[model samples]
Target: MNILIAGATGKTGARLTRQLDEAGHHPVAMVRESSDTSVLPHGVETRQADLTDLADDVCEGADVVVFAAGSGGDTSEEMTDKVDRDGAKALIDRAKAKGVSRFVMLSSIGAGDPDPESDLAHYLEAKHAADEHLKASGLDYVIVRPVALTEEDGQRDMTIGDGVDPEGKAHRGDVAAVLARAVDDDLLLNRVVELESR
Candidate 1:
């Protein structure tokens, strides 16, 4: 499978790209011209496109799309809305137009229901809109809502679905593993799952 990974240079996306490559799948790193490609695996395929300004051909040749992109914590709420909400929706639409097989979204835990009082409210709201968009996109989809993220190594032992503890933290590596598996894993197809380190 040829998987196009948005945010492929970021921590989790980078890990996911390598994992897919190691698993003998072709991983296409979707990046901006300014992005640092050094973190990507050697000889990995790349497609240059900015999340904020995507083209119709962005999803061309992709069998699946993993939206692992985000406007960083330091970015303004407007930027978050642009990248997280609008950018995601745009990509989803493009993928649908290009006939991509599946979409795997990396959403945060509280995205299903945002708390207005929380500091991450805006971020969660943006994600919530995107998640809803994906659900209604009429495409095969998998939404992975992981709790707080950590930089720890992947345990690969995860508590998924109803067994997930909301307060627990998930390792980025483990999240990456889950995202890569969602590409074609029949069990995860069209399902929304919460993830936590076991």
Candidate 2:
């Protein structure tokens, strides 16, 4: 399958890239020029472009678009919107324009919450807005809102289900494996699922 991985340089996205590479899928890594591209191993297609401008042809002929991009850590709502909301929106718009079949978003657990008053609320708000937008865009999309992230070393052996507390925490590698599997599964289609490690 042809896949476009946005923010492929991030932790989860990086692991997904490796998995996709091993699975023999055509993985296209969409990265910003200034962002580090060292994480994603060799043999994947690398396209340097900013999400704000969201250059086209990135996802053309692609079957899936995995939006795993984000602007790290506490910041203004403006920055949050730019990288999380507008960034995801730009990829979605381009995916639709290019006729991509599916879009998967690596979101956060607080996405369904309406209040944005915590230290991380702004980030959650940005992700939630993007999730809402994707759901309303008339496309096949899955939004997985994982719990608080942990930098714990590789845990691809984990599992996820529907009833876990949205307040739990998860390993970054586990989230990466989830994205890796999302390309070929229908477990969360057209739904906003909150995830926790098991």
Candidate 3:
């Protein structure tokens, strides 16, 4: 299967690309710039791309597209809305237009709850809004909502089941790996699932 990863420069994105290669899958990574991902599996394909305005024909071609894009911590709420929420929405729309079969999204866990008073709340609100959009979109989609993220280097230690609530922190590596698998055959038809460490 050919998998396209947006925001492939992120913490989980890089590791996920490697795992995809190990599983004998084609990994197409999209990034704004180049980086050490050069050492990624020889099978991995990297492209200079921005997900903000995705083209339906381009996005629809992927067997699966994982949206791991995000605005960094230094960004403001307004930026979060543009990058995280709006950017995500654009990707979904394009994927649907392209007739893509699967879409895996990385959304923050707290996004489900509504709280816009705090600074960080703005980002969560935006994420939540994006989540809603994806849910309503007519595409096969899986939205992984993780809690506070940690840069722990390890495989996924948690097995999140149905009704699982992403209310706590999980390693970015873990999240990435799970999202990749979801895009693969085992969970191919699964619609949506949230993940977090216990």
Candidate 4:
């Protein structure tokens, strides 16, 4: 399987690329031209493309796409909307255009119902919009909403459901493992699952 990771330079994306490699799958790191790819695993393939205006050919041979891109903490809400919402939607459209089979979105725990009064409400709103778009895209998709991310090693034991505590934490590696699993799991097709460490 040729797995394309949109934010392959990020912590979770980097971890995911390596996990996919370990699982004997090809991990294609799709990154911005300005992104530093030195952190990616050896022998991993790379494609230069920005999420905001991705070209259709970027996904030409991809079997699956994992949208892990984001506008990071320092960016404005507009940037969030552009990347997390619009950029994600663009990736979905491109995936379908390129005959990609599955899409796994790395969303946040509160993205299902964003809180208007929270400090991160804008980010959550952007993620909610992207999630909604993916749900309606008529493609095989899995929305993985993980709780607060921790740097601890992956335990590989996680609780999956909507009612899980939003405040619960999960290791980035564990989230990456789940994303890797979703890529080939037929049971996860069209499923929207929230993840948290047990």
Candidate 5:
């Protein structure tokens, strides 16, 4: 499988890129011109593309498209909308046009139903819109909604579904495992699963 991963240089995205490669899939790390590709797995293919302004060929030749990009917590709400909302929608559109098999979205837990009173309301709102866009894009999609992310190593002992702890922390590596599995796992096809480190 030729998996094109957006934000492949980020914490969780890096893990996903390596895992997919180790699993014998071709993982293409989609990055910006300034992104540091040194963090990616050795010999992993890379495609230069900016999320805020993606070209029509950004998703070309990809079997699957994984969107893991974000504007970061320190960025403003406008930036959040640019990268998380509009950017994801644009990527989804490209993937559909390119005939990608599946679209995997890395979304936060609260994105399913954002609360305006929450401190992360802006970020969640952006993710909510993006997730919705993907769902309505008429593509085979998997939305992995993970709770607060932690830097811990992947335990691989995950509790997935509504039974997962809403307030619990998810190891970044474990989340990567789920995203990688969604690439070819029919069980996760077109399903939105919540993830928690158990």
Candidate 6:
């Protein structure tokens, strides 16, 4: 599959790109012109694109698009809305325009109903908006909402459901594995799955 990984320089995105390459799939790292992609695996294909202003041809020829971008911890709420919500929405639009058939969104566990009192409420709200956009975009989509992320290695064993334990956590590597699987798994089509470590 020709998979376009937005935010390919991010922690989980980098892992997913590497894993897809190792698994004999074409993983195209979609990055911004200013992004430092030196940490990415050598010889990996890369395309320059700013998700905030996605071009119509950005997703041309891509079979699947995976959005792993975030605004980062230092950014403001507005930035989060732009990158997390608007950026994702832009990519979805491009995907549809360019004939990309599948999209996998990495969302947060509480995106469906963000708690107003939570510290992450703003972020969750942005994610929720993006998830809703994808659901209505008329494209085959998989929304993976993982709980707290850890740096542990990929275990592959995970519990996937709509209402998993709130206290559960997921390894970044394991989450990447699931995203890779969603690329070709017909069973994951149009599903919003919450992921947690078993």
> Which ten contiguous residues of candidate 2 have the minimum total lDDT?
153-162
Off by over 4 Å in 2: 157-159
Q: Give lDDT tens digits, candidate 3, residues 120-151.
A: 78788888888888888877878787767888
| Per-prediction tally of clashes | 0, 0, 1, 0, 0, 0
- Cα lDDT of model 4 by residue, 105-188, tens digit: 999988999999988999999999999998888889999999999977578988987567888998998999899999999888
Tens-digit lDDT string for candidate 1 (44-155): 9899999999999999999999999989999999999999999999999999999999999999999999999989999999999999999999999999999999998668
Clash pairs detected, candidate 2? none
Clashing pairs in 4: none
User: Order of candidates by lDDT, top first?
Assistant: 1, 5, 6, 4, 2, 3
Which scores better on lDDT, 1 or 5? 1
Of the candidates numbered 3 and 6, which has the greater lDDT value?
6
* Model 5 stretches with alpha carbons more than 4 Å out: none
lDDT of 5 by residue, 30-147 (tens): 9898999999999999999999989999989999999988899899889999999999999999999999989999999999999999999999999999999999999999999999
Stretches > 4 Å off in candidate 1: none
Q: Estimate each model's TM-score.
A: 0.99, 0.92, 0.86, 0.97, 0.99, 0.96
Q: Model 6, 45-152: lDDT tens per residue?
A: 999998778888999889999998899878999899899999999999999988898999999899989999999999999999999999999999999999998888
Instruction: Point out where model 6 deviates above 4 Å.
Output: none
Candidate 2: lDDT over CA atoms?
Answer: 0.81
Q: Judged by lDDT, which candidate is best?
A: 1
Candidate 6 backbone collisions, by pair: none
The models' CA-based lDDT, in order, is 0.96, 0.81, 0.76, 0.91, 0.94, 0.91
**What is the lDDT, from 0 to 100, of the residue 161 in candidate 1?**
90
Point out the higher-scoring one by TM-score: 2 or 5: 5
- Name the Cα RMSD for model 6: 1.1
Clashing residue pairs in candidate 3, if any? 60-98
